[model samples]
Target chain A: MKPESAVVSITVNGTPHRLEADTRRTLVDLLREDLGLTGTKIGCGQGTCGACTVHVDGVRVLACLLLAVTVEGGQVLTIEGLGTPDGGLHELQQAFIDRDALQCGFCTPGQIMSGLGCIGEGRANTAEEIRESMSGNLCRCAAYPGIVAAIADVAEGQGA
Target chain B: MRPFEYARPSDLAQALAAAGPDTVFIAGGTTVVDLMRLDVLAPRRLVGLGDVAELRRTELDGDPVRLGAGVTMAEAAALPLVRERYPALAAAIDLAASAQIRNVATLGGNLLQKTRCPYFRDASSPCGRRRPGDACSALTGHLEQRAVLGASPHCVAPYPGDMAVALVALEASVEAATAAKVVTVQVADLFREPGDAPHKETVLGDGDIITAVLLPAPRGTSAFVKLRDRASFAFAAASAAVSLELDHDRVVAARIALGGVATRPWRSSEAESAVSGERLTPERAFAAGEAAFEAVARTHENRRGIALGARAVTAALLACRGG
Candidate 1:
């Protein structure tokens, strides 16, 4: 049987959008393909990679694992919602730039999104806590030291 | 992934009514969506349990702490009452998955997570758990992460959740709602060993929606220790959950549950009996650990799990003493 599509009305980065989405479409695909918000990358296409990390109702979630229709009326936030180069950068983003937290930049968006969540949850108080909390977002380029430093810098109020 | 119809029911009755033979209930979708993407599971209908508000509550100020199935792992771990009363459960849930996953994955979904056996994940490989008639590749193939205890010749896949192991040690019970009535079953009775039917993992009936898990009030000091390949974001290689009551520095009661080396969340009555009336000395803890794995069957690649599991039990018991 052919699966039916449903209309989902969601608020993304303070902007409301209503779109006809396939029931099988994942949130990551909906963001990248349907909405053209390609900042959320699909690395493992599973929950392990964390490359598709985003925020739904202020909670960090794996976009690849969440169905688009399940998040109806949810407020979604992606890396693009954090800040832009022209509009200025979020504190965490600036910290990432200052700490040199990116080598390939493929995992930066996920790292930033997950880092925002870690800080929002108040779990970035120490280096061990930062590393343990950020373990889901794997950086294949081995940029963990700088990533931790960046998160700590913002969490500890050393950087903006 | 194959296309499927989705339904978000607002109440337990509607949720149970939406479920059918070809339907699967999705809470966090951490495991279900991953398997579906791998083509390991393809259900024609998906019933979303997110809209059921009653399933997301947590009540801890009573004799039996009731944790709603929809309560996320992070929420459960961070609850002050849970941390004070059931430290083993808090540790188990905290050490599982990652921060992002803990924020989204629910307790019910965590209980029902599938194995991490490579053969089971890889569709090309023969896995009895994935297909009942298929061959068991882990029996002769790479068996490092396979089960060492409660394993049958049909399947060697291990249950990969840390929460269930702690629940078994804490003597928790799950409240499940069906179309007919609600039933409460012990966490220990929830799993079925892979004796002949490796495919039948749990005893959950058709249309049974797990509503909540009831944890008895804390009886003793408890701790959970997991030995894994990595510090975090990895499943346990060997783990132990221990709860002990002490009187004048002597063990009055003990409960032990093991993980990462069993077909299911293994409660070791032998280990508990070993230290029931004895002082919890280092030697006695080691003896209890040995007793836990006395009857364990090990393969060529999984022999290390026996010793590692023993050490985990000893370490967990010692940790209960603040050692």
Candidate 2:
């Protein structure tokens, strides 16, 4: 049976998008599927993995757990919203490259987004704090040390 | 996922009106969305409570600290009053899920969140909690994470939330609102032990919405200690929440609750009684912990949880003493 779709509007990276989204469609699905923003990855599909982390109203949330229609008239910031590949990378993204924070790169988007939120919340003052705050985004490749370094660097005004 | 109608009502009355036998209310969708994706829960109508702003209010001015049902775990944990007045509650909320999840997971949803028992989650497995009269796979398959204190022949799935354990120890009351009236119920009485009907988890009636949770004024020093597989982003293997009132070195009053070792938020009046009138000592605390799990029935794999739970209780009690 086909799920009924609803007309929902949200500002994605300063661009207002009005689309007909399935009521059951998650925020991640809305970004990756309907909006053609494939940066947000769905790892566990459950809220367990933070691979689908995104900013809703400037607060970081698990996109996989949020319904698309629930964020009507809200501002959403995904990985693609952070920086452009051709233009320039965000400081955090640059720090990640410099620090080699990623290995397989599957969990990098979530790590960067969560790191941005951690820094924005002023929770990345110390390495321990960075590690604790970024515990949501799991990296199976064991690139935690580098990721922590990159986040710590960006947090301490050492990046970009 | 099964197709479901979504309704975002602007008021509580509309939200209630939209709810029916086949309807389920969603706050942050941390638990409901996950279950829906897993096909564990497939409600025909999804009633969104996001627009009901009254449910998100947090009032901590006086006697009973009122936390609206939609108060997110992050908001509750970050509240200075909640941290100072009810450290156990704050700690429990802080120790749950992750930063991203905590930002959106509501207090009401946390209490109503289902067990993380592998069998209950995996639809293919025979789970008495997920499917009535189904053989509990956790009973024999993997008993390590199963409940020990509140086990029945039918189910051994442990209640997975840390906030409820703290709330129960704090002697909190939940204000449940229905179409007709509102009734306040003790937090400890909210959950039903999984017996013949493991699927029936809570005592909430049809269309009963938890509006707020009222927490009594802080009596004494409280602490929450959780032992889990990892340091963060994991459910407790054994956890304890203790609130103790002491005169000098002697315990005047104590409330003890254990989690991750029971089918529900297990509050031990026996443990509270054991600690009362006794000096805050390691031996006494250990004895009180033992009293809490005196009649605990453990499976072959989860026997360690019994000992671990006792240790957690003792540790929390000692922490309350500033030891």
Candidate 3:
């Protein structure tokens, strides 16, 4: 169904974009559909799953739960912005790869996006804290051990 | 997400006026937006309170701090005043949803969040709250883990979120603005009992907008505890928010409220009086918790309600004592 209202201007990964989207359209759908930035996925859709996670105004938010109109004039960052095309992943992404933190690859993008904010915000000070913070995003494969390792690896390397 | 007309009002007055026949006031849109997508709210008008600046402020009003309804859980949790003076409220927000959801979920939205009854979320299910004529599937099927307190003839649903208990414990109040006038109501009396009207949650009329949540200064050491199947992700099976004002080693004042086990946020002066004059002790805390829940009528399958609620209340009291 077409959304009856809302015209929003969003800066996705530093690129200015405009769309006359509906209130029903979520930030994740806007990114993936209108802008074709499908890097952000949708899982639980109820904000329980981190699959649709993104950073809005320098903070992490579940895009699945955020209305497109609510984010007008805000800066949004997704996993697609964290690294270069030269295979040089962000430090968190590199740590995830080094630690084999993913299995099915379905939750990797969300995990990476959340991890970026976790490390960037300096909240991943301890493994326990990372585990506690990451509880919202579920890994059906239960790949927690590897995920923790990836986060801890970054914190440890940072001398945290 | 079902298609709907969206309006982003720049101010509170505009937003309140915009709320009408099928309009919902959305702040953060962390919970209400999802429900709209589920078609749970087929409101033709989606009024965005996001741009309403006055509704996003946090300031002191007399002895209490007035937090605008639009303040997100994450922002509220990170506030210095919230962390210092309202640890229980802060913890409740910190423990809710996730960092991601908290970043977008507002305090007013948290209180206004619908029940987490799986039946209610499933539109096809026979839930009285969703469909007037539908039978309460939860009343007969999978009655375990349903409401243990304040169950009504129309529904046996449990309020899922954790912030309500904390707010109730702190004696928080709300400023509700309607198309006609704005009124202040206590958090303790905000919810309307689901006697015959299962759909009515708050007393606010069709065009009312929740302007702000005014939280009184916590009287004592405050703590909020939730007992859930999972440490996170899951809603509370039982929860309690306890505030204790100690006269050195003796209890001077106490406020207690419970969640998950009640249809609405349950506050018990009866429970607080049980330990009002006693010295801080585990036995006293236990006594207060039991007294507060003495009126609780737990069913067979969810007998754990009393136990979990008691444990949460006692734990909060103990936290007050720093024990």
Candidate 4:
């Protein structure tokens, strides 16, 4: 028996790659283990936790539940591929670092991804709205008020 | 996880043939993959259905909006049409898990997903529904959120999808398929009254796959009011999706469905008809809400469902009047 495996070609962090994987292998595993993109954390293997968040064709998806085959011809962006690193950081990333929004920093990537989604979709208009939109990304340290303030700062700044 | 053969078919016909006796089709895989990891589903051949282009469109054909089963809850809610015409459906999608899960979770998987019953999750607990012939743990353990309607004596597990509640209230239908046949069943008629077959949730059998959910176009007024423990992402404790038709300020037609409180997606057309033709004043709307749960059999934990469901009905009914 030629051990049953799925062959999928996907674009990760703007690079195209193909691999053979078991049906059970999550997109997160393929990203971290195979592609060497470990910026996407694995908080809860189940869908409840947002640690494994990544942008799939501009939409944030839980990497653990995402099958690599689903994104065969689609674009994927992990935290490593987020911004021009030598050119400083993305606005949300700068907000987190500037405001001390991150405590242990485990949830910062997921938080930034979700915040980007929020800002991109025009849902994070106010502090309350930012909090609601960012509810999916959990910080065990409960560093939420600062997170909200940082995201809200950007939203308000954009308006003024 | 048991190593299994995997094939991604691009279209429906290829998907149909691949869904043979030993093969099970996977879409989204939020639920099935979980079960597979837990050793609940043990098929030797797994068919992946993500590339079926037809299963991802949300289009209005004739009367209803048909959502391809592959469409994610997040994607469906983002559709401008659903946001304008069916806020309940959009709200239900929003209230399901969280933005991350919603993006990856498909409409078909959400509907076809299995129980949250702790015993069933255990796999060894052997609820009659989980195994061929075993005792129902829901009857003994926490049975508050168990089904009050259409529950078989052997199984009273609640149908745990919020979208199903809104769709049932909106009079939606679902398309199901297996290698042998393809068919449509009203969302209302999908879940059978629990009888001897405790494991079976809907008319779809072992080999069948849900293809799409057809949502009848909005006729009157509708809203979904869900009450949960958290203001954030959580399942409904008891919720109501109400669609009411008003004539000259009086309700002429009503469709009511309950969520997080029943075995199947609970729709009470009788309760809706009770307030039909009555002025949808606060009093009448309240009365209609109360009437919706007339025969609701409550257990130790979910006595709150009846009252909460009534309040939800009033809220949804008020939404119909749209200020």
Candidate 5:
């Protein structure tokens, strides 16, 4: 059977786009391949690796596990949308830079995205809490201590 | 993944009307999309249940707590009522997957999630659970995580879920909708042993949609302990959930369930009976754990898992004492 297509009007980072999406294509594919949002990297096609984490309707979720059509009419926020309006880096991104949280930088976008979710969910209160909450996003470079410190620095209201 | 049509139903009736043998109801899409990507499962239609408002409702004040099928694991875990009254369920959800997954994974989907058995997941491998005529690959490959209880000659892949184990111990029931009417099935009876028909996992009929999970009034304090290869983002090697009530140090009531050590969400009646009447001491809890796995048909590969399961049971039961 030919893969069915559905017209999906999704708002990404406050910008709306209407496209006919394949039912089989994941949200990550739609975001990167279709919308040109290359910041949302696909690490593990499965849900295990949180490299494709994004916010749908203000809730963080794994984009790889969701069909592009399933998120129609929903508001999505990816790594591209997380920056400040004046092209300034988001506080979490600045915190990662300040704390030297990233090594290979492959998982940084996801870590920052999930870190924002962690902070939004009030899970970045402490070091342990941040680690537990950020466990979803894997850093193969093993830059965990800095990652936790970065989240903690932001959660502690130290971000500048 | 194979090409399939998608439909988003706004209500239960519409969702039910769209159901068929070739159709699948997608809630979280965590398990469904993963398996579909592997070409392990291909359905003609995918019915999106995300817009069904009725399925997202949660009734906590009632005698039997009604948690809607669409309630995400993170949403369920964040509820103060659930965290305070049913800590075991909260812990089970908290310890599962990760925050990103919990935000999307619904309670109903969590219970119906597939096993983590590599052989069963790899479509290239011959798995009886995935294809009936195909031989069980886990039998000859890696049995380290296979079932130590409720296993059959055909398959021994353990059920890799923590929520169902906690639900079974708490005496929860699943409300499902069929073409005829809504029916309730005990959480313990929802899963089936991998017997001759290793392909069939649940008792629900084709096109049956789970509506909600009903939990009876809070029985007592409960706890969930999971033994895994790592702390987070990994399936349990062996885990236990225990609920206990004490009358001045003497045990009044007790319930126990095991996960990652069986083919189904295992409710250990023997463990409950062992700790029921007696004061729950450390030694007594250990004995209860021993009784929990006494009937298990242990083998060289799964013996360690059985031992870990026993210890997990003891740990969970002991944790419930101070709660």
Candidate 6:
């Protein structure tokens, strides 16, 4: 049988969209394929790696594990939404650049998104805490030291 | 993945009404989505429990602490009351998965999460736990992740979860809404060992919906210790949840539960007996740990896991003593 579809009304970043998506389509697929927001990377589709991390209703969650239809009424914040009001880079994004947090830059978006979540959740107080909290987003390039430094810089308001 | 219809039920009644043999209730979708993608579970219909507001509560101040089934692991673990009173449960939630997973994975879904057995998760493999008559591939493939306790000939896949172990040690109960009426099941009894039917993991009926998890008042000083391949974001290779009530120096009561080495969340009566009436010294703690795994099926494949299981018990007990 063909997959069922649902007309979903969701808010992405600051924009609202009503899209007809297959019930089986994951949130990551919906964001990248349907909405063309390719900033969020899909590392492991089975939730093992946190490359598809995004914010749904201000909570950090794996997009691959969530069905797009299940988040019908949710407000999603993707990596593309982290820019400032003046079109400048977000503090965390600038911190990532300043700290050289990316070697290959594939996991950088997810790292930045999850870094915002960690700071919001008060898990970015120390370098150890930042590493433990950001353990979800894996950078295969092994840029963890710079990632921790970038998140800590923003969390401590030093990068601002 | 097979095509499936989805329904977002707003309440418990509607959710239970939609339940059937071909239907699955999904909250966080961490396990269901993963398994569905693997073609392990191809339910025709999925009832989304995310919109059910009544099941998302966190009532921790009452006598019998009640945590709604829809409450996310991150939400529950962040509560100061949980960390202060039930350290084992808090630690269990904290140590279970990554930050992003805990943010969406609910307490109820975590308890029902499927085994990480490579054979069970792969659709191409013949797994007794996935199909009733199929052979368990883990028996001949890899024994490192197989269960050492409560394993039947049909299946040796261990239950891969953390919170359930602490709940069993804390004597928690689960409240559910069935088609006929509401019922409460003990956390320990909720999970079934791999007996003749390895597929029957729980006693829940087709239409049964878990509503809440009830926890008793804090026992004595409690701790949860987990040993895994990685320091973070990995399933436990061997773990122990221990709660000890000390009368000055002697033990008044003790509850010991083991995970990662058992087919289910295992309560060790042998370990309880070893330390209940005696003072909990380091030697006594080590003895209790050994008692926990004394009856386990020891093999060359699981020798290291058994040793780690014993050491986990010892570490948890000593941690409860503030050592």
Top-DockQ structure, candidate number = 5
How well is each residue in A6-79 modelled by candidate 2, as lDDT tens digits? 77899998899998888988999889988899999999988777899999999899999999988888899988
Window of ten residues with lowest summed lDDT in model 5 chain B: B294-303
CA lDDT, every model vs. true structure: 0.89, 0.89, 0.82, 0.79, 0.90, 0.90
How do all the candidates rank in terms of TM-score, highest first? 6, 5, 1, 2, 3, 4
| True-vs-predicted CA distance for residue B99, candidate 3, Å | 0.8
Task: Supply the TM-score for candidate 6.
Answer: 0.98
Deviating ranges (above 4 Å) for candidate 5:
A1-3, A158-160
Find the 10 residues in a row with the least total lDDT in model 1 chain A.
A1-10
Residue runs of model 6 more than 4 Å from their true location after superposition: A1-3, A158-160
Q: Which portion of correct inter-chain contacts appears in model 3?
A: 0.92
Model 1 segments more than 4 A misplaced: A84-86, A158-160, B297-299
TM-score of chain B of 4: 0.92
CAPRI grade, predicted model 5: high
Q: How big is the positional error of residue B50 in model 5, measured in Å on the Cα after superposition?
A: 0.9
Question: B1-323 in candidate 5: lDDT tens per residue?
Answer: 88899989888999989988778889899999999999888988999999999888789898799999999999999999999999999999999999999999999999999888898888899998888878888888876787888888889899999999999989999999888899999999999999988789999986888999998987878999999998788999999999888887788999899999999999999898998989989999999998988876666787788799999999998899873
lDDT score of residue B145 within candidate 4: 66
Per-residue accuracy of model 6 over A1-160 as CA lDDT, tens digit each: 2348888899999899998888999999999999999999999798877889999999999999999988888999998998988899998999999999999999888888899999999888888888888889899999999999989988888432
Q: lDDT per residue, candidate 4, A6-119, as tens digits?
A: 777898777888888776678899999988888889887767768888888888877887766656777888888877858668777888887889889998888888877777
lDDT of candidate 2?
0.89
Number of the candidate with higher DockQ, 2 or 4: 2
All candidates: TM-score: 0.97, 0.96, 0.95, 0.93, 0.97, 0.98
**What DockQ do the predictions score, one after another?**
0.78, 0.73, 0.74, 0.64, 0.82, 0.80
